[model samples]
Target: MELEVRNLSVSRGGVPVLEGLSFRLAPGRALILRGPNGIGKTTLLRTVAGLQPPLSGEVGLDREAMAYAAHADGIKATLTVAENLSFWAQVFGTGDITPAIDGFALDELRNRPAGGLSAGQKRRLGLARLLVTGRPVWVLDEPTVSLDVDAVAMFGAAVRRHLATGGMALIATHIDLGLDEAEVMDVGPFKAKPPKVEDFDEVFL
Candidate 1:
């Protein structure tokens, strides 16, 4: 199934940020969102992921088909790396954590508590959760924040593998992931204009 966003308008803190944005991501494809920081990339991603409602337009997709990963690791501090993957696996009913453990190179850290891991290791463990999601579309925001060069390459490889299996990715990142085939959308053109005084006056009228 494809993911479609048509004439989507989104806001942050009740103020509009993007308007009239549209795109379609087919199976096995990737779309990278680009713009200046604070340009509402996160808001757009969240809206698409159904984490927040859009001010207008439509995000057409089954909520179950998309898996979202933000800057936060989303791991349980008290659980071991392996346990964390297993938990998400169970949540998604995928029931297998081996690939995720190996994909992110978390094998050695599997038995260690998540809270004890270094920043990069924690990030890896967090990302590994995506593999177990079994969802077709990945909605990621700054996925490489705490990763090193090698780890970034690992992530790039994982994404390629996912696409190879007909999975799609919607990512917002500044650095290149070596995904030459992926399309980039610069959201600068969609920046929302401030509402005029009369527009606000209509609210109370």
Candidate 2:
């Protein structure tokens, strides 16, 4: 499986943010997006995931082959840890979640409600959903947000396992998640330039 971005452009709230960005990710590889805040890392991910339309150009990939995990944990607070994982597994047409359970060290908390988990625990559960997706491509936004050092290590190992199985990942994060093999792309250079002083003033006309 592969992902191709050709001259892609993205905008937020009618303001162009990133432009002319292109990249390709082959199987068993990862691409880490690095940039300052509000540079459209998340926008680019959402665009590629097909959650939102790009301002221009194209992203070539089967939507079904990619699993998107936004910055939010996206867990139902009322559901138990096991229940949350099970729900996603069923949705993905898989009856087995043992690997995801063990991968994120959620065995002991399986019966615990998601509401009772700490911020870090909730983040872990959110990431575990990727395992249930069974998709070859993973798109994660700031996946390491609330995770501690040890949990970050676990996340890294899980990502490594996914890559070993011919899966690829596109991640946007500030801190290092310890994915040494993943190629890096700085979004700064891709940011769209601001309008000229006269052009900006003319917009009020």
Worst 10 residues of 1 by lDDT: 196-205
Give the top-scoring candidate (TM-score): 1
The sequence of per-residue lDDT tens digits that candidate 1 reaches over residues 1-205 is 8999999999999999999999999999999999999999999999999999999999999778889999897988999998989989999999999999889999888899999999999989888999999999999999998899999999999999999999999999999988999999999999999877767668787
- List the candidates' TM-scores in order: 0.96, 0.95
In the range 1-205, model 2's lDDT, one tens digit per residue, is 5898899999888788999999999999999999999889998899889888899999889788889999787799999999999999999998789999999999999999999999999999999999998999999999999899999999999999999999999999999888889999998999998745676668887
lDDT of each: 0.93, 0.92
Clashes of each: 0, 0
Clashing pairs in 1: none
RMSD of each: 1.6, 1.7
Off by over 4 Å in 2: 195-205
